[model samples]
Target: MKKLYSILTTALFCMLFWIIFVLQDINLLKLDSQEVITGIIVSLIVAYFTHRSFIKEDPFWMLNFKRLGSLIAFIPIYAYELYKANWDVAKRALSPKLNINPGIVKIETEVESEYGLAMLANCITLTPGTITMDIVEEEGKNYMYIHWIDVAATEIKEASNTIKGAFEPWVRRIFK
Candidate 1:
């Protein structure tokens, strides 16, 4: 039963990716039934290998499956935030103020999983005005060192919370 579930889940995820890729390319699926069939075949092959490779003893990947909805909701919002941040940074860079603090600060994050840490780090890097320097895992805690364009008062804490706020709840939905 578990194996069946895993196979189905993996197949479904692959199929989703295939569809997204096709739609992104905006290739006319109507005239090109071949593309659809090819995508399905590819998705199936990818799913089978992925399932075989990570099957059993590593349930966390599947556990993270529940976060799909969160991931969907986050992407658009984060994209917009990143776009806004880009403009802000561009303007700041061209301005006389140069508005950059260029400091590295330690931010404690509640997300402990490697996936969660990675997502948070990527989010920081994607957003304008910030760059993730390093992730420090000590005493069972995860801290991300980030360089910021504007290190406002309580900067580290605020940025930490911002990073967490972007994806933590959604990740919780997916993983737990």
Candidate 2:
């Protein structure tokens, strides 16, 4: 059963990857037959090695509509944060004197699942002005050590709230 689920998951992932690759032009109506065939070949090769890693305890978890919806919703929020952070970083860069109060701050995350914690760390790293230095599990709680370009607050709760605004909630919905 596990092997069957892995195989199916690999096939689905391959198909999705092919679709995205072929639709890069934003024209789904026209697809080249040669490209489609090549995509399938490449996807199959990738799936062969990666399928096992993708298999979750719940084989049908990927089919959850609520999780998909959460992922979709997260895109816009992430984009907004990315844009805002980029602008802030650019402004700081262009200034004569660097106004950054650089420091490492520890922030507590309620995300218990490994996947959720990883996603949260990645989201923080992707945003400008912050990089996730490390994730430490202490006393059954996950704490992320983040290097912030400007350390606004040092307190754990305040730092966590400021750094993880909107991201934690969306990640919880998608991965928890």
Candidate 3:
């Protein structure tokens, strides 16, 4: 049952990828027979190799509507953050004075799952002015060491609040 679920999930994801990347067209009625055949063949091969990693635990968990909704919601929020960060970086770069106070700071995370922590770290790194250096687990807490272009806060809680912004909560919902 788990294997079947994994195969189905992988095939679905591959089909979505094919539509977005290979097809590059939204009109399904215009799709050629050859293209449909090719998509299925390629997706099946890819699914066979990648299914295990995606459905390591319960296969049905990922198919839940709540998690799917969270993922859909997260996309726009991430995009907005990415755009804002890029603009901020560009402004600082164009300015006469380099207003960067760079330093590595440790920020604690409440996310217990490895996937959740990884998502948080990646999100922080993607944001402008911050790069995640390392994630360390100490005394049952996860701490992310990040290099900040501007060190606004020295304390852990304040720094975490500043660096994480709205990402942590969404990630927690998605991965928890």
Candidate 4:
């Protein structure tokens, strides 16, 4: 079952790659026959090479269909929030108020995997006015040091939630 799932996932990604290439018109030969043959050869090579790593652990967990559904579901809402953040940043820059309280705060991350930690860091960096400075693991827990443009209350949990609410759940589904 695991091997089957892994092969399927690899095939899916290969199909995705072929689609991208076709859409981009990147095939060397204009002939459909040549393109199909090339795509098949590439997919087989990629699948064989990538198959082992794909199922060594939890490939199905990352391929969670429900999580993919949720991600699609959240796109519009997340886009709106991102737009709002961008406007807020622009307004703050233009306003005389200059409401920035830049500070570095240490926050705990519940995500146990390295992939999750990387996702958390990227999430913080993606959001306006926050950047993950460092991630330190101690006694099997990740502690991230983050720089925030506005730091209200010195609570670590609050800082942690900023990344969590924005992107953690989706990342958890994808990589945890």
lDDT of 3: 0.88
- Model 3 lDDT tens row, 142-168: 999999988999999999999998899
Summed over model 2, clashes come to 0
Tens-place lDDT per residue, model 2, 1-176, is 77777767787788897798768875777767877787778777777788777765666675799999999989999999999999999999999999999999999999988788989999999999999999999998999999999999999999999999889999999886
| Pick by TM-score: 1 or 3, better one | 3
All candidates in order of TM-score, best leading: 2, 3, 4, 1
- Winner on TM-score between 1 and 2 is 2
- Across 1-176, the per-residue lDDT of candidate 4 in tens digits comes to 87777777787778777877687756545548866777777886788788886456665665577867766766775677578778878888999989888899888877777766886687677778778899998898788898888886468788777644666666665555
The lowest-lDDT stretch of 10 consecutive residues in candidate 4 is 54-63
Give the alpha carbon lDDT tens digit for every residue of 23-108 in model 1: 77685545377877887788777777787654544433644544666777777877787787889889998998766766667888
C-alpha RMSD values across all candidates: 4.3, 2.7, 2.4, 3.5
Order candidates by lDDT, high to low: 2, 3, 4, 1
TM-score for predicted model 3 compared with the true structure = 0.84
State in Å the error of residue 5, model 3. Answer: 1.1
Rate residue 13 of model 1 by lDDT: 76
Better of 2 and 4 by lDDT: 2
lDDT of each: 0.72, 0.88, 0.88, 0.74
What TM-score does structure 2 among the candidates reach? 0.84
